[model samples]
Target: MRIALIGRPNCGKSTLFNQVAGYKAETGNFHGTTVTYTESKVRVLGEVVDLVDLPGTYVLGGSNPAEKVSHDYLGDHPVDVIINVIDATFLAQSLELTLELLRLDKPVLLAMNMMDEVARLGIKLDGPALEKELGVRIVPVVASKGRGIKALFLEAKRAAEQGILQPRFDDFQDDPYSRHKAALQLSQRFAVQGQRTLSWRDRLDDIFLHPAYGYVALAGVLLLFFQAVYGVGQLIEPPLLALFDSLITNLNTYIDTGNLLGVLLNGVLQGVMAGFAIVLPYLFPFLLGLGFLEDVGYLPRIAFLMDSLMHRIGLHGKAIVPFILGYGCNVPAIMSTRTLEDSRERFIAAALSTLVPCAARLVVVFGLVAFYLGPLYAFGLYLLNLFIIALTGRILTRLLPENTPGMILEMPPYRIPTLRAVANKAWFRIREFIVEAWPTLIFGSAALGLLVFFDIAKYFNWMVRPITWLLDLPAEVGVPLIFGVLRKELSLIMLGQALGNNDYSAVLSNAQLFTFTVFVVFFVPCVATLVMLKRELGSRQMVWVTLITIIIAMGAGLAARIFGLLL
Candidate 1:
């Protein structure tokens, strides 16, 4: 049997799907978060069934990419049951979608989610009456808290097995506006407005969504968020780095350093150290904070705040999530572009979002700038990066003009994030690095080590020397720049190795450090990100994006070099 979860944007449908589907789909507090459907297999009531989580849509005939995908999937595929999830607080607004779902004549089960929020708002819902009136089964649920999930799935199983097609709304009009009117009527009949009072949601929204204060709050929240992640990474990185350094020392004591074999093994160890001791320490904490921001519904508010600024670049608020996600990692940032309706916007968003220094690149910025200069300098570098991105975006838009409409985003009420959901999400993203990228790091390091032993590594450095020479840095820095594309942090790790010292300040002047770090920040994305780009935007576009980034990096590096000399 095939069971599908369907609902309007921000109705907790994806949340409900996660309760059973094990975080298989991305859930956000905004509409169009899940632009594509995800399918997973599960056993329901002693029978195995296919459960599909679809992108949220208000009407089956909607024109947006997410809505069209949902509509097309449901129409083309065979679904045994449709689980229509609704936000209990907004029964009137939600029923518009629910009413439309009934017209499909499928075995429909209403999963009224966020019941806890409904009760807190002093709203009264006659679930039985609505269920009876619509001639369908309804299950009241608080999906975030895992309340009523088991019963909801069990009822869904029965509905599918029994082939209970929901009663059709023959009197309702064929167009979406008519169903919306009928939905409001149904909400009035079954949902009583029981002396509704302002809840914490209202109070928080007033502060969080305020024009001036909201921007201040956003800055404060993001600053604190990054500070905490950096603190965690700082606490953990040194000890691990020392341990790995000692191991390398021990390895050197047993093997002759002058030999080719020793070079290869040391290179392999450096790769291992780079991934575990350096990258993972910072990455995990950053992902957790990002997950918190996403799950707690702050991301859309950010999109809201940044909408006008985004409009300056030919895109709107919807494009900002990818930029925000880019901070965690570039792969997902590129993946998130599918939510945009225009192909032109997707390509533009994907290209520009890459300029947001990911945590991997953050490794370089923090190591070189924050540690050597100061956090203030690092912050300024970030501002400079954004400025460059804006400049690049304007250029891209002139090349590809946009006719798409502005963002139509929904604000999901903030909910306390469940630890399980947050951890699961962080791990889900981190696993991509550990499983796919980590081994590549290890091998790439060993390969570099092999090249050094055979005396071919210098030629590689010679090839990249033009960039470093142009920026007035040591020719040896060329090696790290070339290898940095494999895994971003490799640039830092290999920088220490190339200079024959781990202390960056002792080996390099301040201007060189600033210029080199700036170059890394804007350079071509790492191989993992490149693969993701190819998968998302096709091979030809991937090459196009890469070439564009190289041009941007070179221009930015020259500018930073000139500026650093003045500083």
Candidate 2:
């Protein structure tokens, strides 16, 4: 049997899904967190059942792509049971969607999630009365805490097995206003509000959501986040690099360095070493921190704080989510742009998101710029990337010329981020980078190494000499620049291999190093990000984005070279 989990945004549906599905789905306290559906199999009542977590939608007839996913799936797919997870604290608003699910003529089990929030909010809900009125099994659950989940699924299994399709309002109209009115009437009958008092969440919101202090808090939090990533990388990278270096030295004592076997061992193993030594060190901590932010409900606050800045760039505040996610990886960042209601905004957001320095680009920035120059110079490059993104966003906005929508975001109550959830999400994201990206890096490295072994790299270098001269970089950099599109870190790793040494300062001056790093930062995204861009924004748009980024990268490199010459 196949069961579908459906609910309005931030209604704890995803939380419940992750719990029952063994943390297979990513949970966020924001709208459109799950832009696509996720499926996993679970055993309920000794029966193996397929469970799907659908994108959250406030209503069935919504226009956004994320909502359409849920709207279409429910209409087209056959499900044995529908689990409508409701936010117990907001019964009136949540029941509108609940009413829509009832009309689907499927066995529906209402999981009243966030019951702890209901108690804190002083909202008194009579579960039995509500169940009788709605004519469905109502199970009160706190999904984050795993409270009442066993009973929730047991009731769901019973509903699915019994094939109970109870439609209380047979003649109910499927319009929002009418359903809202019906939901309000129903809520009044079963839910009573006790005396309300300010909770700790409300007190924190005074500072976190403040017009003035919110921005300060955001900056402080981000500064700490980046520092933590950098600090953790510093601790792990040296030992790992030393270990790999020792292994390579020992292996080379027995194997010839001039043969094909040596080339494969040196090239492929170095690529793998670079990924673990450089990329993963920074990426792991960054992902873990991101997961904590999402679970703790701070991401939406960042979005809220970014509303005005996003507006200046002709985007809604929610666009900040993708831009922030871009720091970890651009592929999913670009995909998350689908959450925006406007197609033009989606295109502009995606284009700008591609320019945001992902972890791979960060590897080049920190590995080269910071490693040789200083942390300040490396930090300046990130600031430069943001400036470029803002400028590009302004240009794209003008070109598209559409009215940007006002931000309508729900600020979920802050909760302590669970270590298990954070670890699961971080591992999931890191696994994708390792499983999908590492092979391509290794293959590209080996292929390039073979070309060099055969003395064929000079031909490719000559082919891109004009570009090299334009950027004031040595002709030897041309090959790495070409291979950089395969993977951004490849550019840095290949640069070391191409120059025949890890000490780039020996061959290149500070000016050239700065220029090369600048170029790599703004160049076209990696193969993975490009494919994702095409998938999200269409082939035509992807072409335009690619061309635009290439132009910007060359232009930036030129400007950086001129500045270097002046210095």
Off by over 4 Å in 2: 165-172
Give each model's whole-structure lDDT: 0.85, 0.86
Candidate 2 lDDT for residue 415: 81
Over 1-567, each residue of candidate 1 has an lDDT whose tens digit, in order, gives: 899998888787777877887877877666677878899988766778899988888778777566887899988999999999898898988888887787776889899998988888778899888888888899999998899999998998888878855555566887778887888998998888788787686799787889999999998998898788778878898899899889888888997768877887787788888888888888889889988988888998988889898888878998998999899888878988887888889899999988899988998887788778877788889999999999988888898877867788777878888898889888888887888777777777777767667778789889988888899988888878988898888788788877878888898988889999999999999887899889888999999899989999999899988888887
- Model 1 backbone overlap count: 0
TM-score of 2: 0.96
The digit string of per-residue lDDT tens for model 2 on 228-322 reads 88888888988998898888779879878699988977889878888888788888898899888888889888888888888888887899999
* TM-score to true structure, per model: 0.94, 0.96
What's model 1's TM-score? 0.94
What is the lDDT, from 0 to 100, of the residue 358 in candidate 1?
95
Model 2 steric clash pairs: none
